[model samples]
Target: MTLSTRPPAVRTSLPARMAGRLTRLTWIDLVVAAAVLVVLYVILRVGAGTAVSFNPARVTRVSTDPADLPYYAARSLLRMFAALALSVAFTLVYAYAAARSRRLERVLIPALDILQSVPVLGFLSVAVTGFIALFPGSSLGPECASVFAIFTSQAWNMTFGFYHSLVTLPRELDELSRSFGFTRWMRFWKVELPSGAIGLVWNGMMSFGGGWFFLVASEAISVSGHRYALPGIGSYAGTAIAEGDLGGVGWAVLTMAVMVVGVNFVFWRPLTAWVEKFKNEQSEATDVQRSLVLDFLRRSHWPHALGRLARPAAEVLGRAARILGTDDRPLSVDPVRRRGGDAVFALVAGGLIGWGLLDLLGYLRDRTGLGVFAEPLLLGLATLARVVVVVAVATAVWVPVGVRIGFSPRLARIAQPLVQVLAGFPANFLFPLATWFFLRTGLSINVGGMMLMALGAQWYILFNTIAGAMAVPADLREAMDDLGVTGRLRWKRLILPGIFPAYVTGGITASGGAWNASIVSEIVTFGGTTLTATGLGAYVAHATERGDYPHLIAGVAVMSLYVVGLNRLLWRPLYRLAETRYAL
Candidate 1:
């Protein structure tokens, strides 16, 4: 303690002070971080730039070569980031609406079902035309098509994750927020969003993998007789496949694997760690809420600045809340002013759909005649065949494992990320490899397609099943234990029934993913041959290649309509069964 008094006589060295400061800016660390940011910004700038029309013929000609690898990888990374921005925007709105309104949940859940079920090729086919029309005079139309393709791949899982988190609020968590009279915005940010952390993270991971499933079609743009490819991983792979270059495929695969692992480490890991920190630990009392950021902010300069600004912001938000008719009262045990909500929602939805259809028909008549239309019966069969095979395979693989892991929280946590990593991996990376392996072995096109679809869709079953399994009541588990219901009996009587809701949810989501994946899966480029099977996805893919806008719209419309009708007729009833039978 006396050392300070004696040390006052001793002067601190300037060199020591400078050395300490310099240590903070370690050359290695500074360079690496700065380099990463610079690289990322450059990639983003290029991605957001105008589309480059690299000749498709040249791409085909040089398919298996290693020359354009860097050019293509850079391009794909840009598109991936762009797709990410769109996905986040979509997730925010969808999650918010589903959280806020019951009627929206009803309409949107079905709509999402249809959206997800419609194949990616169908999306590309229709979206390519609509997007082209929007930017009628430029290459922007092709870029828009590519962006939409990415959207189809990534949007569904995130939407479901957000939706699931909103509706599955723990009673205590809801009550705690209500007691504080948190505003709708505060409730969403502080409560619903946090609750959905696991789901959102899971979805983000899945969306990344799902992006891979569509990379080929997104990059290798073919409209009518004109084929355009922007340099990206998909384009590179497509070229590699065309030329039968094993080395290029191998390089792309290695690069993709490295990129996936690195991204997960940097972004997903830290985010997961932060979320895990917030997660309620078993030993911690339920009432305690330790918000690390909030605690820091309370003591920081920003909070004081924010405090000065709060009143004006509050007033604006207050007025908005009043107009929305949301009261400042505590959470009601019963419903609050629920009348006419459904009717209003229904009217709005009907009005929008009516407007959309009329506009669509008008555009159709002007652009192309009705004589080119394909019959609905054939479309339906094609859709059905794809759905049946995907569902069957997904169920068989994910069910038992999902249930097993669901029962154990530790296992579920570990397995969840593994599944996510698997989900994010681009299927295109595998196509060349799969093509190489299958062609030499003489496997059929159908076999390869099924494999591709299965890769994308299987995670849905696993994830949803785990969610359902975790939702099972502890008391029920205890009762089953007491009754000596073990092994097969336990699974049959307790686990299956307990997780039925999640299974249905998983099945619906999986079916959609499978359909989306089928486009690329059904069409294979291997050993200089492009192999395709007859399916709605194939039809849509062909139409997109042809730049046949009318046919494209018709194909997408049929698929979307089929998906919607099927959900209403089949999955809706199953969801009802789960809600009534299992929901508390």
Candidate 2:
């Protein structure tokens, strides 16, 4: 018997082998090259379309023809990814600060609550004009504003997830970092990042899907008084709706689903599989996750060859990071000194908050007097009732389902596309049918509003639950199974506690997202009819449409006050419990 020593090769004729020898290109190389070129084409076309669309003197209109859906999908996807990049950057900085510093945590968390509660229209009302002024006649201004709006939809949930990951960082990892004498930067970049990676990726997927509805809405609803849409599928759908072209609208939605699946396949599925490298397990997952794209990349020659070429550069950068990271000792602060520092920070933060409040009050008083506060406050209560109900229902439903999916890698892989499609499918995609049902069934806007908000908000709970379930140690899972843990006993003894921290993060963010969604949910218009629910969102929407800036400001302020107070009263305590009792 004889064994071949050459690298794996596909069957080929003698002439093909001769051609490969002469050209220095194997069949595998050709296939890899084709794949690389296809990826590059998608990237370059997306970038070029986005760049050219931001012309100051030009006005772009969305095309509704089904044939144009592919191009529109590309543009919309580019915009969504741009917003996602911004969200990731913001989460890294903002969440890190909140986790590391007690003083900053107090201020930043509440600020996050308020920011998450502010709806898309509220953001656009301020951001659109400022972006236009900043860019000075460049259409890039409105484009940037649209990205920011989507960014808002994503950033807070991601930030909360990362922050939870940090605060609930496993004790073993912390001890290992201390034992290694790792510098702060090294600890963060190497240890903390991998620890949080799963949570961040899960939350990022949730945010992407959750933000899609806003992507479409932001197109038609960017400006206060008039429509300012960019060239994307969202705009295409909005244009169709405005023109009453049902066929065009249906095509736009089909295009959206395709875009979501494509992104999941190429970007997220690969990343999800790659993160498995960071898992801490004595035994590997029984059914390993797979991505065809990831598998090909690992098997290909070009990428590994490129890595070898870039090794020197990578080493140089690594050396630079070490040189820049001067702090090597673990963080240890004196209790008294920490308290003093917190006191100083509190005074400064309080002064800034106070000044802003006074300014807001003066604006309200001068415009409509103090009596104007009564309406928004009462309306806020209505919205609050709706939010509480939605959050409760979502938590009860998704927590168990997410746990089951998370425990099985095969199940998780299968669910990714289906979940993304569900999360990304905007409620308004079915608004016409819903409107007809609402009228036929005699359903009021109150119930309809709750349903609409859930479409966007519930995913936060599901994603966080999945992340939490995955975070449970492999050894612990095995022990539970060995002991014959099952059903309610299993959930009670292992599952609930393990996922508690992430569930808290999810619940808080979901609540805030529901509040943010109110603007869209509480006000419905279809078939030349308008249905307004008695909530804070309707109040804010009506005020914005009327160009009542001062009133809009008041409405936002009241909404923020309600959200902040609720967080202080409820979610924060649950988070503290997660930290003390349930953290891995």
Q: Per-candidate TM vs. native?
A: 0.75, 0.91
lDDT string, candidate 1, 284-335, tens digits: 3222222333343334444354577987886786678767867554443344
Positional deviation of 392 in candidate 2, in angstroms? 1.1
lDDT of 2 at 471: 72
Instruction: Highest lDDT: give the candidate number.
Output: 2
- Model 2 C-alpha RMSD to native: 5.3
lDDT values, one for every candidate: 0.69, 0.83
Clash pairs for candidate 1: 63-239, 63-240, 72-232, 209-423, 209-424, 212-426, 224-546, 224-547, 449-521
Clashes in candidate 2: how many?
0
Off by over 4 Å in 2: 1-33, 49-61, 302-330
Q: How close is candidate 2 to the true structure, as a TM-score?
A: 0.91
Worst 10 residues of 1 by lDDT: 284-293
